[model samples]
Structures are given as structure tokens and as C-alpha cells.
Target: MLTAADAELARRETRVTAFGLVLDPAALRDRLAARLPEAPRAVRVDYLRYKPGTSVLAGLVLDTGAGPVRAYAKAFTPEGAPEKLAKHRGLAARAAAGAGGGDVSADWHSVVDEPAHLVVGTARADRRLPGVGQLAERPGRATGPDASVRTLRYKPERRWVGVLGHERPARLLKAHPPARAAAALAGHRALAAAGLPVPAAERVHPQRCRGLLSLAWVHGTALDAAPADERVLAEVGALLARVHAVAPALAAGREAAPARPGLDAAAAAVGVLLPGLAAEARAVARTAAARLADRPRTVVHGDFSADQVMVAADGVWLTDLDQVRIDDPLADLGGYLAAEIADGRVPPGTDPYDALAPLLAGYRPCGARLDRRALAAHTAAALLRRTAEPFRHRHPDWPVRAATLLTAARDLLEQP
Candidate 1:
């Protein structure tokens, strides 16, 4: 439940509709005047709405006599007040306080939670911008869950522009939890340091809230957009091989697997909304679990697929490291193969053995070969898990697509 004050804050944050009906900036100013006893002169107010992948955010830039203050706001509507917004503000303040200018690192202290209000810290000028210029020149747009509420391209002078948030009711997906998002960001940075072909990540902004982690934009075409050429495939294979080389280590004495969520738990949550398909999905998951139990475990890209990889002039730069986890390496291979087949990149009747060759040619197996049985099981598991995703349910062809993939896995399992 939102307090009266918070509710009012959200209402003030609603963006103007696309029909040219603008929000009354004066009225909002009046409200703020009453809230803040200082009654600073509001010079200008612009409601900049941004959709990052799947999350919709409105940034309220209040130019006042005191200074320019920006607030990144997300509205919950009937979902009530978002639990993470205040925390995000607090974290942002902390990050800004401690972060020095220049260099890419996790700027974790930018959030601030005061007794009277919450504030997300802003980066002051004097910071060195590493990849901002390259990103700005690339002109990339993100949709789906990968969207950002506000994306900033930092320059040496701390200059930035907030792109993609003008319309009202923008839809954006909540980012993965902060810890996992950070880990994933850290993983990408680590890979880049090791000279692996991965997106370079400099923590532009730390976790201000539980779900908000801002990262430097990587410029490249998604793997799905790249031609299925030998070069592209080889790049992906090499990138994954290098990532696998960095063995998993315990962070602070707790073994950190890749930041991927539990497949069983995700499936169970999906089952609640899709009761009719629960039994079959659960059974498929069980079979996958049982089979995977016997396979060798290794570091893997938990959500490997064509869409997750990006092709660039330099090489394949993998993004979305948030899903990296320690699991049967076969699971990653199976997932990518299953996605390729379903997307019609590979012929329907193509034998898994033949498909494995090119994939492995680039991947360069680190150790023991994953048997067909194990691959089949892992592929089935990946399909079941993906089908249970919330976004898949929204797609009209999801059920049919899921069923088809399941059948493919079942056929493979029954053959040998």
C-alpha cells in the first residue's frame, strides 16, 4: 500500500498522453510547492518518458532556482506502489557520493533515502566517459524485456541525453534482481578484461533500487539479426568457450552460480496462471531434472539463444549476463540448438549430431563430450522452462510453438 504522500507523488509522475493532452506542469509545481516548504521557483519541468526493453519509466526533470534535479519515476497503477523505487533512489545517492571520475566500475553508492523524501544521485561533471561516444553513434533501440527506462551516454564532461520515453503508459519489464544484475554486469566486465568477446560493462549507475541497475550501452546487432554465416557462428562459439574458461569461484565463501533463476520455480509460477498445461509441463521438467542430474556440471550461459548474442565488427559480444549460472554445460548447448531449430535457422529434420559439429567447432569442448541422451534431456528442460515464461504466454503462437519443441525433444529421447 502506498502512503498518501507517495500516491500523490505517483500521480504527479504520470506522463502526458500521446493525443497532445499535456499534464499541467503548474499544478504539479503547486503540489510540490506545498510539499516542500522552500517554495523554490520552478523554471521548467519536462516529463520524459522512457521504455527500456520492457520497463516503462518517466523521468521528471525539475529545473528550479536552486538547481536541476531529476527524478526517475515508475508508476504501479493497480499494482500499488513499487517496493524498489525508494531503495533505488537511496542506492543511487550512495554510489554518486563515493564514485570517482573516470574508469568503469560498479558505482554502488548512488542511492539515498532521507527522512523526508528519497533521492537518486546524479553523476556530476568531471567523470571520464569510456564507451559513451560509441554507444551514442550506434543508434540502438531496445524492446521487450531488454528495454531501459532511461539510458544515458556519458561523456568526459558528464554529458548525457535520456532517450526513448515520450509517450504515456510505456511498458517495460522489471529488471532482474539487483544482486544478480550486478553479478551479470560484473561477469561481462571480467570477460572483457580477459580479452573475451563480450559486451564491455562499466557500472554507469549502481542499483538504486532492488530491480534498477544502469549499465553502459553496448553497440552491436543482436545475434538474431546477424546472418547465420560461419563467421558469426564461430564468433559465438569462441565467446562462450572463453566465458567457460573462467571457472566459477565462491564469492565471500558462498558459491555463486550464474545468476539464473531456478527453472523449477519459474515453471511452477507459470503453472499457476496456466493450470490447463501444468501437468504436462511439470512432467517434462521432472524428466529433464532427472537426466541432468547425471551430466557433468560446468559454467554455462544459463539463457543462451540467438537473440542473446550480439554480432559486431570486433566479434560476438554477449550481453544479458544476468542469467549466467553454474549448470550442466550441455544445457546451454541444447538451449541454443533448440532455439535455432525452432526459429527455422536449422532444418527441421537436421540431425542433432550434425548440428553439434559446427556449434562445437567454435565452442571447443573443455572436457568430456555431452551424450545425446543428456543433450535431449537438457533441451527438453530448456524448452519447458522457456515456454513457462510470462512473455511467451502473451504471444499468440506460444502454445503451439512450445508443443512443437516438446515433441522434438521427445522424439530425440525416444530414438535412442
Candidate 2:
């Protein structure tokens, strides 16, 4: 069980990142006060994204003398700080001149370029994030008309996803760091060529879309949000079966993410956050590593979850296809089920098991053989890996939530 001391340890560890100064709200308020039009009362910042040693971005509500202004502050490597700030200054100038900037309307885009914070890091991820918005709104592109680019998720210097339209998005945009964008494009093409139910990539003018992957809008409610309907579940099961059978041959040029390292990393993070569960977390990962290796390997969604599934009348479509690579096929199943159970992913008042039964029922007849023991181990590992999520996602009671997830993993492992 996690005591008060254990929770304190977890909170303290969050402040010890490589970019410690950039992640500190107090430091941010001081550093940016001079840059703003008027420095006044206070600043409230929440970590939007943090990738150790690479980048960190914060969303802030600054209490200036004028009023409150919401802005994003992206980290920069010391070597690139001058260049990055210059670029933003240019962006501010353009906006001030009324030319506008990014995907935000020309009228209000200036808010994004001011009161920036600087830090030593790898590169500027925030640079092209707004550019994808520009590409989405431009005419004669893969982006259909009238859709707006709303950021769905962001991990600085890593990857970002934007939905160009809401709920049933008119277009989808996945942006990567300049170095990794090409591989992402290749991965999408490979899946599309294999006749998977992947969304079609839109063809945009090549001039300004360097690190952006734009897709024709996919129309469907997310699977986790939709009712646990039988038809969609069966379709998902069959789709996974096909992908597992065909993925190996198709994976020669694609990425490979083995289960062992990911599990080991998860265990280490849990050890750091909840010392009481360190031994148990290690056991979960070790057992999962051994069991996962015994099974035949195939391409797996490295981060599969209910959110990645889109249920439409025609079929089940997979979103966030960037991590599709070779690994234990059961990793996909374990991940999906782990999120469903731990995240309370099913609709309100619905038991996750009620959803799980029909999903397994649909899965069994689809030519895929599952090892229940391995699935259990992987699910436990998945839960342990996600122990930090509540904290990362800004839950007010993160310590309790993280400890409860750790306990769930232990229970899953201890079960007969």
C-alpha cells in the first residue's frame, strides 16, 4: 500500500526532470515576465507534454495587468534558442502586421507567439505544430474545405495529432519532428497498400507541409465512446486477425518495438513513483517478458487502446497508426483490455467485463489463438506501465489513482 511518504516521493520526482527550469512554474513566471506586454499578478501552468532530455511544453493562464491570457510555452535547446526565439518574434511581427499566423484565425493568432520561455533542449517541436493548421485550411489540399485543426494530443519533440474538425473529424493531421516525419509517411503508405481499413492520406502541396501527414477525414464515433455493440466488436476482432496474419510480411521496412524493453521501462517508472510496489512491479514486467516471448511474434499496435478504434457503419478503422510495428500480437490485446479495465473506458454504469466478454466472444472465432496466461501477464504489465498517467494527465488526486492502478496490477497477477 502507498503511504503518505510514498506519495510525497512521487510528487518530488516530477520536479527533477532534465529541463527542470523549463518545467517550473515559478521559474517560468520570472523568465517570461520581462517578455510580456505587462508583468503583473501570477501565472498558472500545467505540463502539456514532457519528453525527458528532449522537450517540454506547458499551457499557461497568465494573469497580466490587462487580464488573463492563455498561451503555450515550448522548450528550446540552448544551441537553437536564439534561432527559435527569432522565429517566434517573426511570427509575432507577422501577426501584429495583421497577416495572421498558424491555423488560428488571422485575427487572434498573435496570442500564441508572445511571452515565450527558453530552455536548453534538443529541438523546436512547437514550430510546425501551427503550420499543420495552415495546411489544413489551405485550398487545393488533401484537407477538405471548412474543417478546423484542433490539437487532439501533443508530446513535445515527439509526435502530435490534430483533428481537422471535431468528433467526426473532416481531416486528421499527424505531425512529427522533422527527422521522423518521413518514416511516419512511409508507415502510413505501407498500411494503405495492404488494404487495411486505414484512412487515406490527403495529397497537399508539397511546399509547406514538410513534417505534416494529412489524412482525408475519417467519419466515425470512437469505439470506446460508442455503445458496446456486437457488430463493431466482431469487425474489430477480424481486423486484428488479418493484421496479425499479414503484418509480418509487411513489416520488413517498418519499425520493431519489442515488449521486453517497454515492460522494463514501465516497471522502472513505477519503481520510481511507488517504492512500496517496486518489487511487485518488477515481477509483473519480468513475468510478462518471459510469457510474451514464448508466443509467435507479429506486428502489434505498440500503444493500442479503445481510443484508437473508430467504429463506422462500414467498418472499424484504426487511428494513431504511427506505432504499428512488429511485437507480440497479444501486446495489442493486453493494451486494449488494460485501458478498458483500468481507465473505466466503457460508458457510464457499464461494466468493462460486459464489454470484454462480447469482445472475446467476437475474437475467438476469428482464427486467432490467445494464451490466457500471457494475456493476463501483459495486462498486468500494461496497468503497471500506466501507473504514472493519472499524475501526468493532471488529476488532482494522482497519488491515490497511481497507487490504485499499481494495486490493480498486483491483483491481476495474484489471481488464479
Best by lDDT: 2
Looking at candidate 2, the ten consecutive residues that score lowest on lDDT are 97-106
Q: Give per-residue CA lDDT, model 2, range 1-416, as digits (tens).
A: 22354336535544323244444556656765665555536766544454434445665555655445444566654544566667666655553221212232222232222223353111121454534434423423435554445555555445656666654656777767555676666556667778888887742444654567778666788888998787778778777776677656666666555668988888777676566778877887777677667567776656778788888778898777777777777778877877876676633222234545666666668777776677777777788788877755555576677777777766666666
Per-residue error for 125 in candidate 2, Å, reads 6.7
lDDT of 1 at 267: 53
147 Cα displacement, candidate 1 (Å)? 17
Score candidate 1 by TM-score against the native.
0.54
- The reply for model 1, stretches above 4 Å from the true place, is 1-179, 205-217, 250-263, 266-276, 347-350, 365-368, 390-393
Candidate 2 TM-score over all chains jointly: 0.74
Candidate 1, residue 349: CA error in Å?
Answer: 6.1
User: How do the residues 1-416 of candidate 1 rate in per-residue lDDT, one tens digit apiece?
Assistant: 33342234235444312101112344444545654424436523233232212222223444545344443323222222245445455434433322221211122323322322322222221112212222222213222232223433321122333333334323211233334445655555555666665545444334332322334444567888866687677657767776666666521122333312455664564454345556765666666676666455556677788887877666677766656666677777888887877776775446666876765777775444558788777666666655633222223344455556555655655556
Tell me each candidate's TM-score: 0.54, 0.74
